[model samples]
Structures are given as C-alpha cells and as structure tokens.
Target: MPIPSRAALVEHLVRTRIAGDVATPRDNNLSHYRKLANGDRHYWLGLELGDRWTDEQDVLAVMAERCGVSDDPEHRAGQDTIDPELTVAALDRLAARLRKAAAGKERVLFATGHPGGLLDAHRRTADALRAAGCEIVAIPGGLIADEGMVFQVGGVAVLERGATLWHTHSPVPMAAILDGLARDGSPLPDLVVADHGWAGCAAQRGFDTVGYADSNDPALFIGEAEGTLQVTVPLDDHVFDPRFYEPMTDYLLDAAGLPV
Candidate 1:
C-alpha cells in the first residue's frame, strides 16, 4: 500500500477512531487529569510531576494543547476528542526524529506497554530502523520486573508473566531494561520509541524519547511540555482493531522518508 497523504491520513484517523471523537469517555479523561494533579504517581507514568501540575485545569490545558482534548473546564462529560491535525503534526515531528536516527545509524530501542495493540507497530518500525543501519538495541536477558519477566519479541520488549504477555503502565520494566544494559557495559540507546511507562521512564532518565499517548494518558504530554520528552503523538493508542494503526505507522514512516 502506498503512504497516505496528510488529508487522507486525517480522514483515516477519524474514520477508524484512532483520533477525533475517541472511545475514551470524558469523565475518564478528567479523572486521569485530576489524579495527575493529585500526584498519583501512577498517572505520572514515570515522570516526577511534583507540584507543577497540581491544578486539574492546568493538566487539562496541557492535554488540550498537546493531546487535542476539550479545553472547556466546565463541560466535563460525554465525548472528548483527539484532534486529528495535532495528531498528524506530532506524527510528522516524531518522523523527523526517526529520519535522523536512520541517517545517523543511531542505537534505537523500542518497547510497548500496549502489546496487544501496539507491539506490531513497534516491531515494524524497529525492523525498518535496523535495516536502515540503526542498531536495534536488545535486552541483555529476561530481566525480572514488577513480578514479570521482560522479553524481546519480534523486535520489541514486552513483559511476560505466567503464560501471558501482560499490558503494563509501570516504569519498573523500563528501569530494569536500562539497568541491565548498564550492568552489561552496553552503551545506552540514542533514541527510544515507546509508549506508556516505557517512554516516561526513559524520558525521566534523560533520553531522547518519542511515543504515542491516549486521551487519558497525560504524562507523556506533560513530559513534552517540560522538555523531558522529544515528542508525544496524541491519539487513541488502542482501537477496536490493531490493523487501524498500520496506516498511521505507514504515514509516519512515509513522512520520515523511511522505506515503507
């Protein structure tokens, strides 16, 4: 398939529910913003939000500006949005970084908390980067983290517990991965492509990190707001079909000038 044009990509985003009026409820979005304001570190993903984001309104403002949610502090129910244009703009920015990584043959690490939804996207991007001369960083061993073992599968790291690969938002796995690399005397990645806590923990540790985020996940946007993250693309990270992401990723790679 050919890469989608910007207008076509925007249409795809809304039509397939990747952006626009997403499934995440307005109440749920506000609840997360409030929690982040209340210093619930879980909502912080992995960054230390501290006293800066104490006001829920402030958090909402950041989300609206970056994630394209509603800015109205009074209207707090029903449907919320992820602006397709903002999503596209951020995708372009993320692509810029990927392009640079490919050109420089930089070491890149890719991870995902939404394995069921985003693992394939990460894997595809990692493969492209690796083939473009970027070193696809690997986990040293099956590192135990948060009671689950981290394993690299199909070019991305995911946590497996029991017989199931788990979906997680905790930064412990990323912490464990970074620690393992250090212990093995391996050089750290020049760039990390990830979502959820994987991206957050890396940004908090001062890496050039870029990734996606849902309307409810505000930490990555806040991280970008505070200069901790390189970029954060606003979208519904998980949709009804994982296939919906293919076009978006293709749009990204296409924009980045990577072979798609």
Candidate 2:
C-alpha cells in the first residue's frame, strides 16, 4: 500500500479513531490517573515517582498537558480526548529518533503490552529498520512472577524478522534478558521501542526509549518528562482497528527515510 500524505494521514487519524476523539472513557482514565497519583505499583508500571506527584491534581495537570486528557477535576465521567496534533508531533519526534538509530546502525528492541492493538505497527517498524541495516535484538527466555499473581514462564523475548516481541508488560522479562546478556557478556540494546511497563522499565534502566501511551497510561509521559524516556506518542491506544494504524506506520517509516 502506498503511504498517505501527512494531511491525509492526519485525517485518517481522526476518521478512524486513531487520534482526536478517543474511546477511552474519562472515568477509566481518571481511575488510572488516581492510581498513578497514589503510587500504585500496577499503574506506575515500574516507574519511580518524585514527591511532586503525590497529589492527584498535579498528575491531572501533567496528563492534560502530555496526553490531552481533560484537566478539569470536576469531570467525573464521559469520553476522553487525545489531540491528533499531539500524536502527529510526537510521531515526528519518534520518526526522527528512528532515523538517527538507523543511521547509527543501533541495536534496537521492540516490545508491547498492547500487543493486540499495536503489534502490527511495531512489526512494520522493525521490518523497516532491519531493511535499513539496523540490528533488531531479541532477549529470549524469562519468567515473570508478580506478587499474588500466577507465575508466567516461557515468556521468551522472541524477535520476529519484523522486530516485534510477544506480549509483555513487566520489566522482569527485560531484566532477565539483560541479566543473561550480562552473564554472556553480550551487548545491550542501544534503543528500545515499547509501551506500558516495558517502556517504563527500560527507561528506568537508562536505555534510550520511546513508545506510545494512552491518556490513562501516564507513566510513560511522566518518564518522558523526567528525562528517562526519549519520546512518547500520546493517543487512544487499543481503541481502533489494527489496520487503522497502517498510515501511521507508513508516516513514521517515510519520515525515517525508510521505504514505505
């Protein structure tokens, strides 16, 4: 498929519900935001917060600025919003980073918690980067055991030819991967493209990272703000059909000077 022009892609972003008016309910976003403010580990997604974020209102302000969600504390319910412009702007930055990584032949890792929603895009990104001569690293063989949760084993970090990993959210998987790498004295990734806990944890580990986030997932935004994360594209993650992201993938690849 031919890549859409910027204007056309932006139009598709709103028309297909990839951006602009989002489907993430305000209440749901608020619920997560409140959890983040309260320092819930699940919502924090492995990010350590500073004292300034102790208040829910302060978190709201940050979300409002970064994710385009409503800042009104009075908003008790209804739909949430993500500015399409913000998504585009962030994608521009993401693409620039990808271009730099490709030029430098950086070893890259890509993972996603929202595998159902974003795997296609990430896969395409991986393919393009590989075609550009960048090495897509895979960190296989890890187990994640969250407290009070069932232990998940055989969660190997398989890197597809297109550069995507199986569904992953916990930093434990990456931590295990890094540990194995250190044990074998293998090189670590120069960049990580991921979302949710994967992105947060990698950033916390001081890896150059960029990823997507919904209005509710404030950890990546906070990480970006704190300089731990490189860039975060804010949008309604998991709200649209997977194919709706093709144009976006094309845009990013083209922006990176990779073949679309």
TM-score to native of every candidate shown: 0.99, 0.89
Could you give candidate 1's per-residue lDDT for residues 1-260 as a string of tens digits? 87899999999999998999999999999999999999899999999887999999999999999988999998789999999999999999999999999999999999999998899999989988888888999888869999999989988999999978899999999999999999999999999999999999999999999988999999999999999999999988889999999999999988888878
Stretches > 4 Å off in candidate 2: 142-168
Q: Tell how far residue 66 is off in model 2, in angstroms.
A: 1.5
| lDDT of model 2 at position 97 | 98
Check candidate 2 and list the clashing pairs: none
TM-score of 2: 0.89
**lDDT per residue (tens digit) for residues 153-200 in model 2:** 222133222333344456655555566667778789999888888788
